[model samples]
Target: MVRIDDLQVFIRAADNGSLSAAARQLDLSPAVASAALKRLEAAVGAQLLARSTRSLRLTVAGERYLEHARAALDALQSGSVALAQDRQALSGSLSLSMPSDLGRNLLRPWLDAFLQQHPGLSLQLQISDRVADLYRQPVDVALRYGVPEDSALVALPLAPDNRRVLCASPDYLARHGAPAAPQDLRRHSCLRFILGAAVHERWSFLRNGERQVVTVDGRWHSDDGEIVRNWALAGLGIAYKSRLDVLADLRAGRLQPLLEGYDTEQTPLYLVTPHRLMLSPAAVALRAHLQQCLDAYLAGPRAGEGRNDSCD
Candidate 1:
C-alpha cells in the first residue's frame, strides 16, 4: 500500500517544480522530503521522477503513474469529506485556465461571485487563447471549448456553444453589398482567426442538411479574437466568431451577422480537469458557480438586442 504522506510529498514537489519548495509548504526539511520521495519510488518499483541538479522531470512511467496517484489521493480526500460532510468547510487552492474571449466575457463575473462566497480559498486564473495542456499545467480545473482528446482528464459539459458566425458592420455591408449565398463570399474580404487558420481559413456553411466548406482568403489574419472583432467593427472585413461574443455588437448596430442560415452545428463549452473520483471543495464550488451563471446568461435576452440595421 502506498503511504498517503509520501504520495502527497511527491505531488507537492511535482506541482511546485522543486523538492525544497514542497518541503517548505509541508513544513518538512529538504532532507526528509528527499528521503520520502526515494522511499515512495522504491515502494512503487519504478523511477517515478528524474532528478538533476538543475531540473526535475517525470519519466514516461512517472507520467503514467502520476495520473493514477492523483486519482487515488483525490478519492481518499473525498471519502473524508463525505464522512464529515455535516461539519466540513471548503478551504484550498484552485488553479484555472481558460480561453481569452470566454474568460473575459463569461467567466469574470462568475469568478467574482465565487470568490465572495468562498473567502478562504485561493484561486489562480490563467487566460490565453492558445489551448492549455492540462498535463503540462498544474491547474486544478479549466474552462475550455472544443472536445478534449486527453483520456486522462474528465470533461464536464458546462454550456452549449458552437460555430462562430460570419459578421461585419452595416457600413461594410452597404459598401461591399451583402453576399446572399456562401459562394459569393469568395470575392469578399474576410478577417480570419489564427488558431486554425490553415484549416479554418475557409469558412463552413450548411445547406439542406448537406455540409460545404469554403476556403476563404483574407487580407488580415489574427490569433486574437478581440483584434479580429475590432477589425470587423471598423468595417474591414467579414469575421467568423462566437454568437455570444458578437451578440452585443450585433445588438448595438456595430456589427451584422452575414449569414444566419448556415450554422447547423454548435460546439459545446466544457469545464475540465484531470480525472479524479473526488474534487476538492474549491473546484466543486467553482464548477457549480460557472454552471449557474451559464444557465442564467443563456436564458436572458441577447446582448445589444435592438440595433437599427438588423442581420439576424
Candidate 2:
C-alpha cells in the first residue's frame, strides 16, 4: 500500500532538493524519511528520486509523479477544511419534515424569512401529518408537536410551552353557544382529527388543579390537520389544534379560544434529529430562527386585549 506519509516525504524531498532537509521539516529522522521514499518507489515500481552524497533531485519517474501527488494532497486537505467549515457555517441544504397545518400556515413565512437571510442555505420541506421515519426517510430534521416516541432521537425544543388549544370560529360559536367547560363539549359539534390510526375523540383539560376528561363526539373528522382547522374556520365545528398552528387565527380573532380559565392539552414543538451528532449548523441556526420568531409572535398584541398568548 502507498502510505500518505511516504508520499509527503517524497514531495518535500523533491521540493527541498535534500532528503535530510525534508526529514527536518517533517520532524522525522533522516533514515525514516529515506526509507519512506524507498517504500513509496517500491510500491509504485518506479525510482522517484536520484540521490547522491552532494545533491538530491527527482528522476524522470519522480518528475511525472510529483505533480499528481501534490494535487492529491491538496484535494484531501481542502476536503477536510470544507468539512470543518460545514460544522460551523449555516451554508448547506436542510431537510425538514413538519406537520401540514403548522408548516404551511405558520412556519412557512418564518422559514422564508430565514432563507432570505442565508443566501447559501436551501430547504427541502416534507409537510405531512404522518410522522416521518427518520431512519428510513431522507429527513435531516423533523419539526413536530408532541414528544418523540423514539427515545434515541435528539429532540431540540422549539416551543416547549406550546399547548393544544380548543377553539371555534365566531360564526360557529354564535350558532351553537361555545362550551364553557370540557364536559360541555359533548353537547356541541367538535372537529376531530385522526392521527395515524387513533381518533382524537377524548379531550382533557386542567383548571384550578383539577382534571377533566371529556369523551367528545363530532360530525366531522379528517386525517389532515389543516383540514380540521379549515373546518373550524368555516364554522363547521370547534377544533382542538396545536397552539402554533392556530396562533395566526387566534390573533386575527378568526378563531376564539374556548375554556378560557382551563389549561388545555400540551403539544410542545420539537426539532428532532436522529442523534445529537447528526445536528448540523444549518439545523441549529434554523432552530434558533424559528424559536425567535415564535417568541416575538407570542409577545405581539392579541387582536382583542392582545393576550400574552405565548406560542404553543
Candidate 3:
C-alpha cells in the first residue's frame, strides 16, 4: 500500500528538485525522507527518480504520476479543511515573495494586520527585487508587478489600477528643470532599476493617442527598486516607478510627478501561485483580504479622484 505521507514526501522532493531541500521544508531528516521515497517507489513498482550525486530527475513514471499525486493531496487537504468548525481559524505556514520597495513600505503593515487577525498563521517573507520561481522555490505565492510570463501559474489581480509614473524630488526639479516632453529626458539624469541582466532604462508613455518608447540613461543604477527610489528621493535623478511604491512620498510632497500631460503605461499587480489546487486555505484567505485592502485604499480620501495612482 502507498502511504499518504510517503506520497507527499515524493511530491515535495519533485517540486523542490532536491531531496535534502524538500526534507528540510517538510521537517523530515535526510534518512527518513530517503526512506519515504524508497517506500513510495516500492509501492509503485518503479524507479520514480533518476538520482546522481549532485541532482535528481523524475523518471517517466514519476512524471506521469505527479499530477495525480498532487490532486490526491489537494483533495485530502480540502476534506480536512471542510471538517473544521471555524473556517476563519486559519492555521498554516505561508511563504511569500515580493519586491523590496513594496514589501518594506506598503505591504508590511497590511501583512502585520493580517497576521494579527489570524494568530494561528505563520509567515515567511522573501523580500527581493528578483523574480522568484514558484515551481522550483519554496515560496507558496508571489506578489508581482506586470503580467506573468509563465503560463503554468495562476495570477490573481490584487490591484488592477496600479501603474508606473515618472517622478523626481522638488530639489532635483529645481536644479535640473522638469522635462516637458519624453525627448527632453535626454538632458536629465535618470535613475534606473535592473531586472536580471536587463536595465529598465526604456520608458513607455502615451501622448496624443500615440505610444512613445524612450531609451533613457542615468549616472547611477541598482538592482533594487528601493535603491532607485531612494536616489530619486535624494534629488539624484528622475525615476519611473510603480505608484503604489511612491504614493506616500508623492502625497507628502517629497516626490513630484513629472510629465502629467503624458499617460504612463499601466502594469498590473498580481498574487501568483504555481498551481490553483495546491493553494492552502491561508493563501486563499490572504488573497481575498489583500484584494479588499487594496480596493479600500484606492477608494480612500488619500487616493483622491482622478489621481494618477488610480490608473484612470
Using TM-score as the measure, which candidate wins? 3
Looking at candidate 1, the ten consecutive residues that score lowest on lDDT are 303-312
Two-way TM-score contest, 1 vs 3, winner: 3
* Per-model TM-score on C-alpha atoms: 0.72, 0.69, 0.75
Off by over 4 Å in 2: 1-89, 302-312
What clash count does candidate 3 reach?
Answer: 0
Error of 1 at 232 (Å): 1.8
**TM-score, model 3 to reference:** 0.75
Please give, for residues 71-138, the per-residue lDDT of candidate 3 as tens digits: 88778877765665254588879999999998887787788888988899999999999999886688
Residue 121 of candidate 1: its Cα lDDT? 74
Which of candidates 1 and 2 is the stronger one according to lDDT? 2
User: What are the root-mean-square deviations of the candidates from the true structure over C-alphas?
Assistant: 5.8, 16.4, 4.7
Worst 10 residues of 2 by lDDT: 303-312
lDDT values of the candidates?
Answer: 0.75, 0.84, 0.85
Look at candidate 1 and tell me the lDDT of residue 152: 51
